[model samples]
Target: MPPALNIVPFVSVDHMMRLVLAVGIERFLTELAGFIEEDFRRWSAFDKTPRIASHSPDGVIELMPTSDGTTYGFKYVNGHPKNVRAGRQTVAAFGVLADVGNGYPMLLTEMTILTALRTAATSALAGKYLAPPGARTMALIGNGAQAEFQALAFRALVGVDRLRLYDIDPAATEKCVRNLAGLGFDLRRCASVAAAVEGAEIVTTVTADRQNATILTDNLVGAGLHINGVGGDCPGKTELHPDVLLRCAIFVEYAPQSRIEGEIQQLPPDHPVTELWEVITGRAPGRRDAGQTTLFDSVGFAVEDFSALRYVREKLRTHPFYADLDLLADPDEPRDLFGMLLRAGAGPGRD
Candidate 1:
């Protein structure tokens, strides 16, 4: 007789916390950046799709699904900008990893923190190629839950040592400054977005507002600066002025999706923008001159989530405390999937 089948791993939030604590956030960001860069280098090997979005009156829910040839993954994330006022996280997320061959779920874990980490990692990865060498200072607009992660990622990857923070809500800026007080960064709470962007090498906009507000206007951007636009990821949600995009050499993760959701949405459909992979692969140029402006209009692609899922799966092997769940029913025979359901008496109209 064959041995009993094994149960799949269910990584709870606590299990993920252990993994993150053991690895440390900076190291995880470094590794995640490398994974994302590798995937972008082999961009054609994976199945990609624009995230499926469900818009409600107050917020939006998105499902990002992707797969390499062997592994598959998906993340369910909701963005409710107003939730923070009610003491809830503005973004909450969870994800699953599976084997493409058998379609069996291998792992499941919360992605709220993971999403913050990966978004920062992806931004820093683009900055590595797009920002000027020896870039040190960054202006952070919309200091909220993601501000700390973005600051840390830039500090670790792009050598950002000073951060100028700004938000319409002073409490949000205060919270961000408090979180980074002991993190070895020189933090300055600016009076306005212009003050924050002044003299900064990289400007990162991660606002939570779901409207079309301009955080950075054309007159505010300086030459040779790299812009990480993270807030305007949905239609009617924009952070940069239209002229700012017009003046800069724009780059994005995926073209088709970015054209609709990224800051480039304000530009014409025929407006020329380079894909980040092209710069990574040496197919296109980044920052042509010291005086040229560059923008990375980030919409948080599925491939980045894919990379994050893969990283967590690898980390789970080192820490065994993650719960094991049976999300998929497995039988001794691979072709007897329906048979197992029949044996369990879970057919139509039977509960």
Candidate 2:
């Protein structure tokens, strides 16, 4: 019999890091943004579903899965704001890419850093359409691990040169500022969310608190401003006031999912919001006027991760350094799955 073939690549966090660094962060974000836009334009071709979530007393865990006929992907992520107190990150994540043809995993990767990168890329992609031209200053309401990436993405993609940073925990803001010190942007630590939003053309709320905290009130929002609502991505966790959502032309990744996780969750089921795919596909208008307020309620969609994974896989083609593991047993015959295990020396009492 021919040698059984079951090959899969184990992509570690380090491999993913090398992939990102090799392409350069800016190029990765730019390419990733393009991939996301392309995927959004073909929204109907994908199998979409809201992530399965498991809630706990401390925080929540979620599994987001999607497929596009050929490939399937899923991410396992946890959100625990209190984890930092235990010297852990507020979010921990990993994901897998699988071939839909035979239901075999092709790659497994740590997505903690990749998630951060994809979130920032998604935000910047939305901002490209929703934010007014010449947008320079951004008010970042929550300064956490995501803050620096958001800052860098905006600077690289949206011409953002100034950042007004604020967090309930001053240490988080300090960490963000320290991370961006040599990146060459003007930074200001704000005393309050309102102070941070003042005079800024873009406002990004990525707070970690898992509650109905109103980070952006209606009154604080200015004309012609774009708001990137990155926090409050789960049910019962909201960051924008109802009036703020009403005042802006809201653009979301996926409306059905966004209505449950984005800031639009505050509104009724019938509340009006534009899907980013519509804008990307030219089915809907974006930024009608310079004076109109725009909002991109970002909940970190699965398609963005799909795009990121595809981009990473393509990058690995040139500089391959991933492990191949036997995650699935292969038999010469398709119906011999059980027989393959037996052939692998799986007798009862055999070690």
Candidate 3:
């Protein structure tokens, strides 16, 4: 029998956790990165746009959408740095993948977890091409919820197991350290951002401040370092100093979006920057020399979310850790929309 057209596979938070555990974190990150890379290599084939955002005083809500001509995907995400104070996540999300031909949703899943994983995976993937050759040490400046995931991904993708960790809140750093214990990481709890960046090959600033904060200053960064600026993703929320941006060779997912939300937002509109797709496709260079400072000013693009949704869809084929949700109205006849509703009302118990 054919599957019901109304059935959409749904991976709830529990199912998402089970799926991640079933696939193992490192393996999941590596495979997800592969999907993201494949999509990036065929960059021109997809429809791309900057995320549509609705900003508020508290935070922002965004819809990130993309399609590769065959399938369409989008993620509904929110960022409220103040939410942590209320015992809620600073970032939360969910996403859907739909068949473009019929406009039917194929999969629905919790992206709060997937977003963290994909974000870290994308950062590590960028690190793979942009970070110095054989680099093993990283300065992770933000020890929030995304910190451990970032550490795991860097190790999985780039073989970086030595981490210098720092956070404005000492407890946050302690949480990150405790979570990563016995994970084969050489972890050091640093006193300040400067201490964290000292002697590190790659520096990752994933802070959660919603203001334009100088997480990484020019004086702290040195030659040949790769900076993964992940936190400064919204306008008025940036991590690196403008002078630091000027000092480095920069790359981004999409120029228009990055200009509005990434660390490059501080730079002029005409500032020379390379797209990561160009580097992955060999159309542009990644790291020119060992001494050149490189930065991947990632603002989290729609295509990455598209790739992640597709990855989850593929895994469901074998893993099957999702529940089938009857999300669509399926009528006995294609045009009997009213009849379908009428029948639903007249089910086992008559009115």
Judged by lDDT, which candidate is best?
3
lDDT of 3 at 182: 99
How do these models rank on lDDT, best leading? 3, 1, 2
Better of 1 and 2 by lDDT: 1
Find the 10 residues in a row with the least total lDDT in model 2: 1-10
Model 3 TM-score on a 0 to 1 scale: 0.98
lDDT (Cα) of model 3: 0.94
Candidate 1, 155-222: lDDT as tens digits:
88999989999999999999999989998999999999989998899999999777898899988998
The digit string of per-residue lDDT tens for model 2 on 1-351 reads 753367777778788788788888878888888888888888888889789999889888999999888989999999888998899988999888888997878878788988999999999999988898999999999998899889988987898989999999999999999989988999999999889999999999998768799888889998899999998798888999999888899898889998888788889999888999999889999999999999999999898888887777777788695778777767778798888777768555755
Each prediction's whole-model lDDT (CA): 0.89, 0.88, 0.94
Each candidate structure's TM-score, on Cα atoms with residue i matched to residue i, is 0.93, 0.93, 0.98
Go through the candidates in order and give the C-alpha RMSD of each one to the true structure. Answer: 3.4, 2.6, 1.3
| Native-to-model Cα distance after best TM-score fit, residue 297 in candidate 3, in Å | 0.5
Cα displacement (Å) at residue 122, model 1: 0.2
Q: Model 3: runs farther than 4 Å from truth?
A: none
